[model samples]
Target chain A: MAKTKARVKVPKSIKKGEVFQVKTLISHKMETGQRKNKKTGKKISRMIINKLVCQYNGKEVFASDWHPAISANPYMAFYVKADASGSLDFTWTDDEGKSVKKSAKITVAG
Target chain B: MIHKTLETRQVGRRELMAMFGAGVVAAMGVGMTPRDAMADAKSVTDAMMKVVGDNKPATGKIKLDLPQIAENGNTVPIAVEVDSPMSDADHVKALHLWADKNPRPEVASFRFSPASGKAKVSTRVRLSKTQNIVAVAEMSDGKFYMAKSEIKVTIGGCGG
Candidate 1:
């Protein structure tokens, strides 16, 4: 069994209708199947974050599917328009059939 | 292969201040003197050539933004902006970022569509040492644009 970890961080409060930046980074080796194990002399099976999806208040804000070329410890940042106070959910899935999820809540002030 | 040209077009204080304006240049937080920055630029350029292949002339136009001196190398702020409207008729196809001297040369590559609205991206990256950062932007019309800058890393970043 493999252990996977993910963390999500966002401001506790935000102004409604104002645009704010969101940053995310997941801890993973992102092994590209191309590498070979020195001891076994066999190609190491790929273990990577195949997909990342972010939803704000049940509406999709951003999503991306990664490839072997992506570097280790992938970090992503983007802007989100805060329409109303809501929860932001982040989900990441790997090719190995494993998925990790985390979320953050933001309060929109008038 | 086009990275050589990028190495030559080093963004000096005068040039950088010209493109981004004095406000941006000031925000960069450069601690080193002009002489030191120039020396670091040369070394960083040499390091980039080692990883990007032989004699490839990287072009200009890709806009790269980084702090002149980073207090922490573990989380250095980075931004890449390209001059593309990102419309159906014309758009930025892809943007690639490379740290001249990180353990891994290629940091990240973003593929965009007309729906992206803008060809700009901001993120944080880890720098192992003082080095030059390079960004290459590819347009839908099959043209390449690039930008580079020297960043002084006070402390070694990358969990070493």
Candidate 2:
């Protein structure tokens, strides 16, 4: 309902060929659309963030498909290998095809 | 002869109890249905078939991390890891999660690539009640690994 926001955390420093961790969380209600309006007695249509894609240095690295079972304000963590000095982009899309994108920088030391 | 008769009667009674238990669960499922999302519910068998098809997942190489009992079912933490080298030729393709007793068996799916570098993921999920959380990992080599852990939900999350 409000403006959605996302946060990404990457290691401050990285070494070449080293595996690093990436953690992300987004603020969302994740309405399942299964609940009813107590006063109106009508069903609330499902609206949830359905997909997430993580790209490292412009290439797809990790992704996930979320169902209604995912908790509101989802948080996820995964690992990535440092290839070069670049940015990691994360795109979260909802059931309506509307999406939000966030990015973080990664510097791999030679 | 008297002891033998008692043993036979006990076995029959156990069978009857099992039949009644199954019937009760089926009735509960229907009673909770709201015509749409609830009715799309699935049993464990159908859920697995839809994902892995006819190939049964082998029970190893996968680890499921979850609390034995969740104080709050609204947000249950879950982590899954697979033991693999994570190479281009043999890495985990996707990891699937589902709960056995929820109104709907579908949970979430995680897709990975070689760049992922590790066969692990962590997230939070909502559990409708006490149930087994099943995780299945699909490898690039067409092999499937499976693991399951049960979580007792003290406060049932009925949003499902």
Candidate 3:
């Protein structure tokens, strides 16, 4: 069975209107088409996680378009302002029409 | 085998068909060669032009952070941060990263909205050789910002 895990890191709680860092990592094998199969002398088709979008409180915050050059087990870090206590949802889509979703909740204290 | 003299030549339909087949095959061979040659023959500027068009970004308010020297090129840390208020009227729309010496110049692109709070992102990329990594940021106001840094790689990232 293939293991798919989405790791998200954020502060347990933050003051309202404070800026915070968000880190995410997903387990994936970003395959570039440059490699040739050893057993069969044919080029491997490129397949990678092409897009990742982050939404905070049901509003889009950050997104990315990735290429095959990104390292395997893709990792991305960005900053987001903590306004009110809400949830951050992430969706990662690959070239093969597969997508994985993950979300985290944060508490804002003023 | 058909032998003929110019003065008294004999024409055969089968011979004309054979000649036409060879011409078609030769043309196809020429067409197939360029595809393989083009795979690794694109320049950095050409790739960048496809994204930014004729607008060359100015240098400021954008920071591209990467190592000056990387022992292994397989994985090099890179971070791009832009100074923006992240307000409704002003924000970063997209960020494009590229390696000047890689087989393909464009590495990745990141998009941000005002809700992001800050225009900052970090990731890892592969380097083919010692070259400059360029970052171009497109803002909401239709202005562009640019930043670049060079890295020396001991071991190339792209496998030979």
Best by TM-score: 2
| Cα lDDT tens digits for candidate 1, B1-160 | 3585466455444464453343234324433222121222223343233223233535766777789998887678877778776666898766656677775454555656554455666766767789888776657765656687899999856542
Model 3 interface RMSD, in angstroms? 4.8
Clashing pairs for predicted structure model 2, backbone only? A33-A46
The i-RMS of every model, in angstroms, reads 8.8, 4.8, 4.8
lDDT of 1: 0.64
- For the predicted complex of model 1, DockQ is 0.08
Q: If you assessed candidate 1 against the hidden native complex, which CAPRI class would it receive? A: incorrect
Q: Which ten residues in a row have the lowest lDDT in candidate 1 chain B?
A: B32-41
Q: Which of candidates 1 and 3 reaches a greater TM-score?
A: 3
Candidate with more favorable, higher TM-score: 1 or 2: 2
What TM-score goes with each of the models?
0.52, 0.83, 0.81
Sorted by lDDT (best first), the order is 2, 3, 1
lDDT of 1 by residue, A21-72 (tens): 6778888887766567788766687777766777888876655545443546
Give the Cα lDDT of each candidate: 0.64, 0.80, 0.78
Native contacts present in each candidate (fraction): 0.11, 0.79, 0.72
TM-score of 3: 0.81
Per-residue error (Å), model 1, residue A44? 14
